[model samples]
Target: MSNEKRPYKGGHGKPGHAGKPGNGKFSQGNSNQGSGQGEGGAKRKRRRRSGSGAGVNEQNRQQSQNSQRTQNQRSQGRPQKWDDNSRGDKKRFENRGENRNDSRAESRTGRRFDGLTSVERAARRAKTEHDDTKRGGGGTSQRNKSGHERNRRSMSAREFSAAAPSARSRTADTARATVFEVLRSVAESDAYANLVLPKAIRSHRLDHRDAGFATELTYGTLRHQGTYDAILRHCVDRPLEKVGTTTLIVLRMGVHQLLNMRVPAHAALNQSVSLAREKIGAGPASFINAVLRRVSERTPDEWYELIIEDAKDDTERMALLASHPAWIVRSMRQALVAHGRPATEIEQLLEADNLAPVVNLVALPGLGSLDEAREQGAVDGELVEGSALYASGDLARLESVREGTVRAQDAGSQLVARALAAAPLDGTDTAWLDLCAGPGGKAALLGAIGVQRGASLVANEAAPHRAQLVESSMRPLPEDSYTVLTGDGRQIRETLRKNASALPGSIEPGQLFDRVMVDVPCSGLGALRRRPEARWRKSPRDIAELLPLQRQLLDAAIEATRPGGVIAYVTCSPHAAETQNIVAEVLESGAVSLLDSAAALREVALHTEGANGESVSVLAGEKDPGHTPEIKVKKGAPAVKAAENPTTAQLWPHVHGTDAMFLALLRKN
Candidate 1:
């Protein structure tokens, strides 16, 4: 018997057994001898270890034969090919017969192969054929691995563009996109457009022309949003509120361009639809297109006439035409009569509010000059000195503006700040306070003047974030000239007292300021032109809520002032409750007496000579002789005579081309 492994010979009944030699099988004696020896013994052992039936033995034998055939084919320089037509070949490939579970037998395409699925095999063959074709081999037309025929003919530019309408049609213009984003932010976050627009402009990297366009679009849409909604109610099938926010904003922008801006109707419609499609979805885009198309059917004047017809009275009519809320229109009328202007001026006032205000720049006193701004195409300001009107483009482009010396401020604001600095004080006029200086526009002006006049300013704000803004605004001035404090303006005395050690020069414990600027938070009714969205956001209830804070801040301002020191009680609103009423209540305390605010403003305005080398009167008195009305004091409170010169001054947009800022100068008694 041999020890070497050998192939199994054919047998009749049992493992490792042979039949008779004469019967085409091995002799029985030889088979018995072989079974007890080397190779035969190994086969017997393997069969015993497997513990399987004769079927398993037959599978192993078939696998061994297939392996031998594959090796022989490979040795002949070509692998064995699969035959789809042969059932035997297919069965041989399917039954791996390895006794182990084979995952490759399960094809992803549900069609089995040796290791790859039928689809994968076809793909590989197509890819090989494509490569051969590229190499100039004799192959069929070029096809992708997925078996799709490739289009080899070149297309003209026009044809190519026509082939992809989505790529060309879905994009929105940068200017319109910027405006839409700003409108969304204003609506969603209750943000001011003035605060959000500049950041958006910079982020969008819009050029000066585009920036101007975006600014107009955003402001115009917001200014006339009430009117646009009125028109939309007629155009849209559903309620305005039911419309998606994105779709509504797009519609508003389109309406503004069509009615108010110089944009052509077709361009407005197409751009707006495109913007809606890109930002929202195609469904909303179609809806927007239909609505805007309906709106464009009528001219702006015709639309205005149509909407005004729905008004029930003169107030509602003015509200619709002026794009102001009816309540706001009534308030403006009442405010005009209360403030000594004729009620008829309400129309003019409302019209002014609709007009976009020019960018008014103020060069910080002593630390800044308007010469640089003037050289850059800024004209001299009409209302105040050291100020310029910038209409060329983005003010941030100016070097002086970026340096924070030249600022974008309203002429009315500049007047109030200068009036406070110019108010006659009896005692040492060294210390000043901005009780509610959150944004620090007035504080910066006051701080700059204080630095020149040997005074220091303490800018206090209730919000920490706005206090940081105050600090940033005053950074361009001398560090020692101003102190930024984060605390309630009503608790200014305590805040200043606690931080005595850290106070700026000569500001000691219990030492009062010579001038206190209490620009208290108000309804912001006056700045409707600058912040158009504010008109919609404000209500009479808001004014009522602000009255208490206004009174408390004014009282705090009076207490912080030394005897004979003047406090400029200011509000960007001319509303009677926030202005005259608040001042009258504070005057009743006998802790302070009203000074001639109109005189102070006149003095500040006239302090700078006009281009003709003579004084120009920018006060409302010059235009409306009865601009000053008698102060409304309580029954027992001391009365201010109407015959006396106007003590408080209200700047009107219609009369002065400025925000309707109200000022009441009070001297501590």
Candidate 2:
């Protein structure tokens, strides 16, 4: 909230003013000055001398000649060409030693005003005044009377150009300004805040602390977007949709600062108002200021109480209090019941999604080492192997990360990939497939392991841009070890056959991969802590649209796996429609059977290291031979009834310190 105010350049120092006519004051001998005269006539005046004797007259004449010589000496080569010899003009020029302001003006424009008419002098003077204003001269500036303004001089011209009335729109450059841009991008372009924010911060050159602040403001505002919009609708006279995207984004960020962050009310309001004035129009900014002022009148908890006082049901009340959509609250409740957990945990689940998650990084096996990461203040992950948790600084600064040997991956994601690699398989296990690999985190880890095992992998992405990301992630591996395919994951059988002939290595028609991972895209509800903007972007319709794709990708994986090979069905979500329901639908086809996924995870977890480099266990001896222990649950926690098919594992952030990742291992029959 840098209140580094800039002076308004009104009337003076405007471009395109050079040749324009001006009021005829101070026109003198310059023709550029328009035709007007002041108290004295527009002519040079001579003063009379008091002399009686002839000798005194002679002395006066000598003095007059001496004065002319002095005037000539004062004019220098860059002479004052104006015929302004009046008393006032002489006084003004005497103060302007060595033709100070006029000389500089002449030097800049390559023209001497002494030879010009009054009108032309007026034009040059106007232009000089304009240039002075641009250089922060002779203009009234607004200043914060409270504390010293930090970064006052560092504030770039573009930062305040919106308020300054520029010829072009300017981008915001402060942390809060970056947050506003990200929010506006989310609303206007349907961009993900998490994806859009980092670039904005980098582009603004925000320091580490400012970058962190920007991240928090962006994620927090998006996390509570529903509640903010509801509150804004109450405050505004019109429907919230009628508000422009820029104003709405500014108001949301303002409300977040006022309610969630410890920023002072004035600081929040002023910063948001300033940002609005800089980004949007003055009218919209005034509206935002008024609405945000009303919003700041009450505490967040008081507003919550007011908002939920008339809730129709407990779910609705919970939704308002926790700032989650009613449908999602109900869905999470149902998911809790489906997984044999207490439905009451839904409240806690809702709260957890609002909190930020620690950044998790995976050091790819063989190619990635953990010692360097540990030296850089990163600790080992709590629930996944070779993963590190670093809460501060740029992760890209790490050499391993820069070299593509390690990456910022979720602990839950790392576990699923390792589970597939750790799962016992019979027959040749040389080929692998990531059916929907895009922005390929898991693919890189798996590719590193593929190189370790002397195997080959195909990382297939449905989009070209994402396929490029997959290629970038797999750069550490030999070019031949992994291939990135761009096509629909649903067409894997045909797509693989088409590429087999030209693809390097043993990949060809009729060759089923030893391991196939169908990490289908879903609502992304589970990873909300990491991607706070997702909570606002998703809806019930998203789940409906995704189910078919999820089913198709899983079915394709089944078709693309060898008879004895294992397929890991994964999602960063716990919705039954996406997880159990989709898996159940594919299993009904009778071509594949479920394996003990929980057991596979247990075996993998045994090798997983905690932050202290100790073997992290879900519980003591949970991986004992011939035994599959249940996940530890509360005493009142409902027991999950074992299904006929092998158990699937659902990891929760509150319980597992990972994203709410769902994993199911299936083997071809």
Candidate 3:
């Protein structure tokens, strides 16, 4: 229905201040901002007879046209000359005129119907009338001609545009089961939110900012759905489970706006209400409006207060108000205490789950450095600040990023990986392993570093599907410098040792890798902002379920490192069991010691300035106390002394401006 022509009053640009030197206001309709060009008045009149409509339809159409004409006349009424500004205006208008002719030449489907303006104008007027009836005392009507009719008629192609003054357009609000159909397929079948969203926005021709907004809404709403549905149950007449999925999705979208965002209450409610009418049947539109209005009456803080008020226990308090599952809240609390953090810091941990992860970057060490990028305007961070690569423009689309010289990596991870990579392992040539380097993020940087620094790297990934990531990461590098192995790291170490004597230069003075990276898999709780569904998917016992895997991964990475070599244990979660405890347990074996990763990462520089215009760098990872200081490490013949407790760097949701990642670098004695 967006293609349905609508009328505007006095909207066209004014004439000489006129285009043709007569009635000079710009033509209304979806036409580019310009005065009418062609004089086909006779043809238009001839075609007017064949138009499908009663006299009133013709009248509505004529009135709409007359209104445009009247608006143009009023615009032309202004004095033709307004001093020197007129000459500038004339030149600008002439240039605009040239562009429009060229831009207007290509048209397809809905875009081609600009020629049928009079008909579209009449339909839109009819649709508007129908919309008015539904909004006012007329109550809900399945018959709203504006949205529904527009949507209904939109099934076909027409060269038309719904010229909107608002931020969102008719084209943008386009709803069809098809959108989510493809999206759900991609999400479930392909797990491709990152890939699908970009293509969808680009195909739809959305601008960058709008694309970002849509991405936020979709991911944020999906992530906070547990709490959203809880609130929805209170508002809806039926249990949310009993409602149709479409209605449920619409309600979630509505609730997300009402509860989480700063969208105006009335605007959010009314537009959502209208959408409900169009999306759901008329029966639910009023109910949806009423409930959303009630939800909107309270601010986000007020909504939290209400959620808190309804909670009857500590678990409920955090879960309800913070939009977290109660079990998750409790588990996070246990993890905090285990890390020697105070109970009062619980709110900080929970809040971190809701914020977005800032784009993190790493510059290719030798070619480009973070400090240089920052001096250009990128801001600096506290830890791993030296090697920091500031986001160029949109982290997803900067020219530098596409070129592969830099990448979006978590600052916390960069800190740990660099700490291990740059640590003094006391070996001229070392064999390094990226245990679980699926689709190689860390391995890419590590591989690049290994290549430049006279070291060999073995990037092992258990998952064959993810090996491609490793392959892509090390593309063009000398094949001899690195080996992409699809096998268990534990077994890879066994094989490497068995063939040690057979391999030349492989068995160096102190063989295995001077450093190894274990970017192990986990629930990804620290990355809730990115994987909106993560917090919801994580169970209270996730740490328990994952502890064994994490331990095995760590053990393998440690085993792969040469004596006195470093193992960088990293995860997106700050959970102690998965981070500090994993390192602590391995240390208990007296096989390795902990290193001061914080100090190790300080070796690298960082950038912090905004992307566009003047770019520059800022200090990094300094906010995390654990990141600034080095952890205790064992130094003796291998297994010489009991390993010291490792330093685990946990970045904050705010301070680090990255995912709440955890990193601890451990060294073998």
Winner by lDDT: 1
Per-residue C-alpha lDDT of model 2 across residues 1-669, encoded as one tens digit per residue? 011111122221112121223432222222223333332323211111232434544554554555575578677755544443444445644766556767886898787647688899888887676466455553344344454332112223232322234312433448887887787778768888767886887788889999889988988888888888877877886677656666778888889999999899998887877787777644456567889999999988788878877889999988877778898899888877666567888888888888888888888788878777889888877666787888766676688888988788888888889889988899998899999999899999888888889888899999999999999999988888888898899998888788876454856666889999889988998998877767767889989998888887888888889888899999999887887777776665566667777767776763546789886566224222112223333344333434343677777776677888888888887
Candidate 1 backbone collisions, by pair: none
Regions of model 1 farther than 4 Å from truth: 1-169, 607-616, 624-646
| Candidate 2: segments with Cα more than 4 A from true spot | 1-173, 502-508, 606-616, 619-645
Q: Tens digits of per-residue lDDT for model 1 on 487-581?
A: 99888888988888778976777788899999989889999999999998988899889888888888888888887788898899988888877
Candidate closer to the true structure by TM-score (higher is better), 1 or 2? 1
Task: Report the number of the highest-TM-score candidate.
Answer: 1
**Which RMSD values do the candidates have, in order?**
14.8, 16.5, 21.8
Estimate the TM-score of every prediction. 0.73, 0.71, 0.64
Off by over 4 Å in 3: 1-196, 266-290, 367-382, 386-396, 476-479, 494-511, 601-624, 627-639, 642-646
Q: Write the per-residue lDDT of candidate 3 for residues 417-508, one digit (tens) a residue.
A: 66667776665545777888887778877877877887777777877878877787666456677777777655766655554543324434
Worst 10 residues of 3 by lDDT: 152-161
Candidate 1: residue 156 lDDT (0-100): 29
Q: Please, what is the whole-model Cα lDDT of each candidate in the order they appear?
A: 0.80, 0.74, 0.60
